[model samples]
Target: MTAIRTLLVANRGEIARRVFRTASAMGIRTVAVHSDPDAHAPHVLDADRAVSLGGSTPAESYLDAAKILDAARRAGADAVHPGYGFLAENAGFAAACAAAGLVFVGPSPESIAAMGRKDRAKEIARKAGVPVLPDAPVTGDDPDGWAVAGADVGFPLLVKATAGGGGKGMRLVTGPDGLAEAITGARREAAGAFGDAAVFLERHLGFARHVEVQVFGDVHGGAVHLGERECSVQRRHQKVLEESPSPAVTPELRERMGATAVALVRELGYVGAGTVEFLLDEDGDFFFLEMNTRLQVEHPVTEEVYGLDLVRMQLRVAAGEPLGLDRAPEPRGHAIEVRLYAEDPANGYLPAPGPLHHYAHPTHPGVRFEDGVAAPGEVSPFYDPMLAKVVAHAPTRAEAAAMLAGALDATEVHGPVTNRAMLAALLRDPDFLAGETRTDFLDRHPVLLAPPPPTPEVVHLGAAVAVTAARRRAADPVTSLAPPGFRLLPGSAPATARWTPIGGEPADVGYRLGAAFGDTALTVTVGGTTTELGLRDLGPDGVRVVHDGVAVPCIVRVHPDGSVWVNDPAAQSGWRPEPRLPDPELSAAAAGPVAEVPGTVAAVLVAAGDQVTAGQKLVVLEAMKMEHPATAAADGVVAAVHVEPGQYVEAHTVLVTLTTGPTA
Candidate 1:
């Protein structure tokens, strides 16, 4: 009840670091609780004191409520702030924190448990006079339920997990025939994701915009909405881009939504920062979705627009202070935020979890970074693949979007293939620029996901450069024969040997050295659409090859096997240029380990000494809360099985090694 002197940030990634920053600024001590793998995470460095929670995985670390409370107690923290995800909305965790006499910087336990179930929240929404979509009757035992509006309404419908936020228990059912599969699938996934398979169906509002009102409540009985954020731009039900004051939300609609949000908070007696989410359909009709009983990931956009720090508000509310205002404050300028993930967008958005090689963020006024971790290596795979959240604010939405685009271009991340280019493309897209976005924005639009093709000029220039390099190779002073030519006379013009560009290829011009053109007999090879080599200056001993008027440094070396090693001359001073050679082992293609997505490991069958058939299941990796088996690459004996039961391995982590069978 007294001033929150020390708060234990029981979270990770950008959110933890974000909360720690606010706590430090408020002259409050912060305790960062981390797992073994996250000992080196940025939040640990930013906190006043740090505590080791436990193992690497979520259940072993952040999800362990008892352990987190103990860590808070050990760190001398008087309060526990569950940032957004993990156990943030867990009613049991909240109750436990209250029982431990530590401030839980969120809603009351009852509100959490009420909204914790999809069916219960729907009933509550219906009673609150909020438009609630009709669904199947709720059963005591949480089974993944199913509901549908009609096939005529849409091509796809959403089946959501009842217990928690995330794409874990969510699935898009394409047709009515797929409802059963989708239900069972959603149930299985929800079980793994939230320890409950209970799910409910909503008429899939495909073109719906996710506009949520940020409602804050203090224990002293004050609650209000801080406006809305557009979180519709997402992939696989995961939000990527969010902005405040959704383009579609009018002042009237905002008031209605805000009033509805406050009504729900009052009905449930909810406390702290919570988001009442609604689906603003294409017809401008908004439907009550659900309530998140914690601070949101995209809260910064709201903070920027509303000109109030939600985290600081949470800290103040936890310390038993009022909202400090009688009502929701007027919102300010526009703000946009993009969640930069550590994944390869081109390769089906595969998680590229590894060392961050080069990380640089552009320093500018309007742009702000709520980053948790950094470069120089080791972005742990045993966690969310989100790298950072970059935000930009401006007087106008268009300017904010422009600032975001420029920031993305200026910032360089060489560690992994990120969605940086795709995000930039989305920000500039005419549809997005017009503010017509939907939940299916990413799914329906393939153009935003694809990298922009190279311009025609660049293509032509690259081809020309390659051809020029080829001619330079043939015209070098160390060169010998020009297509093994025979010279007739010394005074006569050297017999010009003609080379063909071939079909669709650049022109290859071959000519012996003229007396004035060069000092040594030169043979110029041309390929592609342009001349390969432009004879710049040829001296008695050395000749400088010029391509595109740029002095390029090229190194030539002969290996022991007489293979040529060509290297770029302008390699960085401290680093030696690596010799490029064909990796003999990588020449042939083969199916490697099974990709580990966001799922559970249902079973791991083969042991280290087990012989397996080509189609046999070696390991099962469950994701989105479903199980998938990783079969053998070919008929072979398991030389080494790297994973065991319940061991979560990432995609391409070499789960098992195989040796050829006896048939060989």
Candidate 2:
């Protein structure tokens, strides 16, 4: 162990900011490392000293062990803290830091190497008499041994990548027929993702809640376990919501699970922060999953409930200080965290990365937000989709639920579509509130209700407001110089404007600028209807005017290229057929030949002369972990094939051409 006074945070974004806050509290000087794009990031501004890692892509910056180590050395940082993701669990990075005489504020390289492999973790769990899923290893050089091992586990087994998490490179097999194929596919994916193809088998539990205990180990040979977190709500094996004092955990179960987790960490000499995950069955029977050898994404909830600064504890433990385990442990209250992601829940939750147009968080007590980026546009596709983690703590679970719901409702993130509403729904749903949920909660019940279609009246009101704002801009030059309108403007509109009139007749009407009546603030005039509007904001972006006490967002936009767009947000939408089919002349890129869309090539189906029809799946492109099929423009023979099965192509890179027309 080393006495580290200056720490180098070998990561970027919010996690880095989080680590620095704790390090700074300990009177430790911090060194921040950043990539080219993140040079001006908040984390950089928070550090005592800053260094650039060079390059924007993760591989060129964060994962480059040499660059990170050099940064630590140059910045005079005696220790490096690999915060959570990127290279946190990389045993190689840990060893290199140790070999360079720098303290790695995490577990030792040997411990990481042992538990980082999921198979080895299972073995450790089994030897410690921890309850593990009934399964057998299928790895062997002898064919007879392979058959015997396969028979022992039988069908409906899972092939899990030994070096993977996040459900990547894991396959579910329901029968022996698909066992080999599934394993092969799992291995390929695992190799591509973790750079290791080794996999093992396990029993696939159809229904279970994911609960994990946080445990800490000390050099003085003492280990203690914290309470468990209910992580039953997950999407694609990634935890979306987490809460402590799980409804499933009684006093007896909590004690039993906590003891088991502590025993494993002590027996394995696991140090620093780690999570021991277990699949809890309905009958209160729990089995060991695997240990995550680094900080977890959902650690904030635990911190809130335990009243502990986990990051600070990590630093103290790594510094060879006693963990202060002289006293007993206690966990009180309830805490919950919801991951705010830059994704569209309506569009199959596809990643929606772009510049944020506007953002504002709900301000209230008992609410904490750990964010990676802030307003003024900072969403990127090259990183994880999570934008922030909003956490709330309360004396009771009900209060916690209400707190989260109110916070999300008050949150204003107008830049992109998010799962805030969905997460809020989960917190308020009866099933979730009672803590009775499974991993398939979202899949079994899609809470995505298409908002009711925008009322034609609102559209008409929007048209009127657009016309008013446009005329206002032309009428007053001083107000035009102001921002769109005002920051979340508050007022009472003179009248509620309607786009098309009632009785199918168009009309125009306005109220006195300074007139008020009881039961209503501003007067509204329609062709045949008069109403008032509780104005929220009146800006260049249009008016967010509420009528009949209902809020309606009106988008008033004057395009830079001289186009006007005024519309209401659709509550829901169904897939509609395109009225205009793609034309050959309208192919993308237009550089002699159209190019392939941005994605990883799943397959190239056509050759130089194979005939194909329109809408045929010519090539499958996988982006953000979803398969998108690119089809042919029209019926034609493939003139030339350019892409391979595993080749990565960017947007507008020519893939194939049609023989029927000159490669337009």
Candidate 3:
């Protein structure tokens, strides 16, 4: 048996950090490889040694197998862990590692090659007696032939890229007219993402549940399955929330699926961690989707449920350890995980990459947070925008969902509008609570997109908390004695500050020191309503506002940009105090449609001096491997196109100027 001494992680972000933690716990030295953009990333700092790939994009850095191999060699790493994405599923990379005499902390190269292509994997599964949906290989450039194949599979089918997963190269087609466009888009995306343009047609189950069984195999010809996880809650065909021990699967069905997954694992001689994905229809029938050849992003749910450390298991298996388990352990509790990304759910979940000013997670029991970066960090547009994965475990599913929802509600994630609010709302959603989730969960429920506005009480409490915090910071021996708002001259009015909640209108808060309680007590008035609250305790720990003989605890922080964050038990809100004077620089915002994120200009659909209607896509911006199109807000004529394809632009950079009367 080969014991791994120095290990290298050939990936970045949360997964890298996760593997590093496990390797370190096992007394193994860890090395991290990063691109130019991730030079100062948390994972780099977490490693004992880090190698610089010296490139800004994945193609020039992480995706380049040669650079990674060199990095491992220079770091003297005997084992390399390709933590999901990047080169994780590249069969050639696995073989190269083997040829270089380094243990790849994953499945064998043969297994990876066999399951790398969706089309080929389906064939293998069908031959192994596993249920699979019929598909047709999309070859050649004949549109008519493609149409006939798509029709043969029936309407409402999927045009999917056979190379990689993660919803990158998959499109749903409703009829014949959409098939060609879907194939073209899927091929382009697949090539850009995976370097493979091969695609195929598969029957689309619009209302199916995406479930996957977590199976582990060892070198001693032993294998076991760890039940299944449900990943049906999705947006843009990507999973948003996942839970283990799927509510839709019964004990009998789970036994059948687990057996099938283990059979396939044994059939392929697969080793280490892998997931066999399936699409379960409403009629209790399941069909094989594709198999992921590495550690899944949602493995935490399984670990939490089974009381096992999957990363540790992978490490042991890579070291040629035998499967110690005779059978899968009975899951103790239900676990739920939600992916927290740096995107805007309100804006169609657009990638909003920017500086993460304040990032924090709850430390409550039964709650676990796997994060990629800390506060005062930047969410680079060069990589995936996922910030962290929050998981919760409990005895019951409802309890687990509620626990997860409450934790998210208490989390303080500032900057870059996120889907935190939406995730929290979905966890508590009625249909979600009833376990009626399917692939079209988001489509069926649109109200979960936007967060509910803060209550009046919360707003009032926020104003009080903000004032109390400011006073505490400004307090001195002399100032403490002065009544609140007591100016040098008489007849002076109390100080009034205009503050706006994150999603609410601005309100003027009048604060004074003298209150019904004592000189230290405070009274705040907003919109002709007054509340008396005394500062019980105020310091770095937090502040307590006493109102009606009840003290409400709050965490108040002032951001570098002058925005005040107030997190209490009721809600978490940011209050931006209106500047006393408007700044000249901020007033120069362009009067045109601007890029909402930093990305390369994929295409410019319109030329200068062209007439256009409202909502016409004028420019397409590609960021984080997703395309975002800038559209016209009103009917106008294009005056000038500021950017061209292949040009990189920053957020708020004007793309195209549209004039109503004439072109400039």
Candidate 4:
């Protein structure tokens, strides 16, 4: 067996850190390569040695095989682990690593090439006696040709990019009216993400569940399945939640699916860690989807359930070791994993990349957090906006789901909008708890996208905290020495502060401290209701509020942008102190279509004189490997197009101005 001394991870973020953790545990030195923006990333700091690849975008950095190989060479790394994304599935890079005398900790390049393309992979699975969906490759750019091809596949079909996963370069078409645009959008997104515009048409199963089996192989022709993960809960075709031991799968079905996956693995002579994904229908019949040749994002659930470290297994297999087991291990307990992204679920899951003002992880039992960014760190717009992966393992599925929900609710993440609340809500959702989860879960339950409104008690607590903080800051060094409520004038007017919750109207909070020393009683008024609460343990960090004789602990954080976030057991709310006088520029900028996120303009569909209807696409912006279209809000003539293709723009930057009605 060839032993590896130093290993280099040709990727960034949590996966890199994960590899480093495993490699370090095995007494192997680790090397990290990063782009310019990721110079001080957590992954880089976790490595024993690091090399800067230079450039920010993936094309100029992570995707550059030459730079990665050079870095490995400079670092004297004997092995390379591509921790998903970037070039993990790149066959040429894997082949190059082998040619350069470096051990590639994955399947052979031939296997990658064979399974990388979804169309070819389906054919291989079909030939191996595995069930597969009917599909046809995209031929020409002609809309009519695409229409004919799509018709053959039937209505409610998916235009999927053959080269990549993660929902990129994928579009759903419900009817003939949307077939052309879906094909165009899918091809464009595919080319941008995968460097391949090749697409295929496949029938869309409305209620099909996405399930994948974790399969591993060794050089000695040994293969095994480590159970299955149900990743049916999705948004925009991307998985949001994953769990091991699907509630819908019976023991017999699991065996059949696992055996089927193992058969494919043996057929391909696959080695290392890989996942065989399938679409499970209501009738228990399953169809093979694309196989991910690299370690999956949701592998932690499988790892937790199986009590195995897949990364360590990968390292061992790369060393030319044989599988020690003849069959798959029986899973012990249930595990659930949720992907926390810096995105706005209410706003089409748009990537919300920015500085994390306040970030606190929950230290709850049975919870595991794999984070990529730290507090006060910036979520760069150049990469995926996934902030962390939170996994919970327990004796039962219900306990695991509840534990995960509580942990997520307790996690204090502020600043840019996130899907934390939505995730927590989904975990606690009744339907979800009952395991009614399907691929259309999110589309069917739109209310979950928007978090429940903060309770009245929580609102008052936030306002009270805001007022207390303001009072502390306003007091002079000498006046601060006085007792908590020692007012110079008897019966003085109560201090007042106005706070406006995000997307809510401004509410006035009037508060007055108690008259006696050590008296934590504080009278707070929110809207038309006034309540006397005990504000004990007041500090810069947090405060405890005793309302109705029940003590409720709260964590409050103030950002430099004049926004205050208060998180309590019930909920978390952020409020921006309403300006005394609104800026005049706000009204003037309301008549244009604005970019929802910071990104580069990919296309401009309208000219200054172009007339457009409501919902007509005016411009398309791409960021975090996803495209977002800026559309018109009303029928209007475009007065000006403010952006062009290839132009970088900031969030809320106006892309097009419109002149409606008489103004036209």
Query: Best candidate, TM-score-wise?
Result: 4
Clashing residue pair totals per candidate (backbone < 3 A): 13, 9, 1, 0
Best-to-worst TM-score order: 4, 3, 2, 1
Please list the C-alpha lDDT of all candidates, in the order they appear.
0.70, 0.72, 0.85, 0.86
lDDT tens per residue, model 2, 137-205: 657545466446566877667888888587766777887667775676667656555667788888878
Tens digits of per-residue lDDT for model 3 on 1-664?
8999999999999999999999999999999999998989999999999999988877889999999999999999999999998889999999999999999999999999999899999999999999999789998999999999998898899999898788888999999998987897788778777888899999999889999999999999999999999999998888999999899999999999999999999999999999999999999999999999999999999999999999999999999998798778998889999999888787788887877789987799999999998889899998888999999999999999999999988888876667887899999999999999999999999989885743335444544454654565467665665454443344446568787765457888776654334424566788998876666555544567676767677777777777677777756666677745543432332435788789888778899878888777888787887778889877789888889998989877888887764333
In model 3, where do residues sit more than 4 Å from their true spots? 140-145, 453-481, 488-551, 579-591, 661-664
| Candidate 4 residue pairs in clash (backbone atoms < 3 Å) | none
Clashing pairs in 3: 484-513
Question: Which ten contiguous residues of candidate 3 have the minimum total lDDT?
Answer: 582-591
**Could you tell me how far off, in angstroms, the CA of residue 160 lies in candidate 1 after the best superposition?**
1.2
Candidate achieving higher TM-score, 2 or 3? 3
Best by lDDT: 4
Task: Give me the displacement of residue 406 in model 1, in angstroms.
Answer: 0.5
TM-score of each: 0.76, 0.79, 0.89, 0.94
Pick the winner on lDDT between candidates 1 and 2: 2
What is the C-alpha local distance difference test score of candidate 1?
0.70
Tens-digit lDDT track of model 1 for 279-377:
888787888888888998999998888788899999888888888777777878899999988765655565666656556677899899888667665
If both were scored by lDDT, which would come out higher, candidate 3 or candidate 4?
A: 4
Worst lDDT 10-window in candidate 2: 570-579
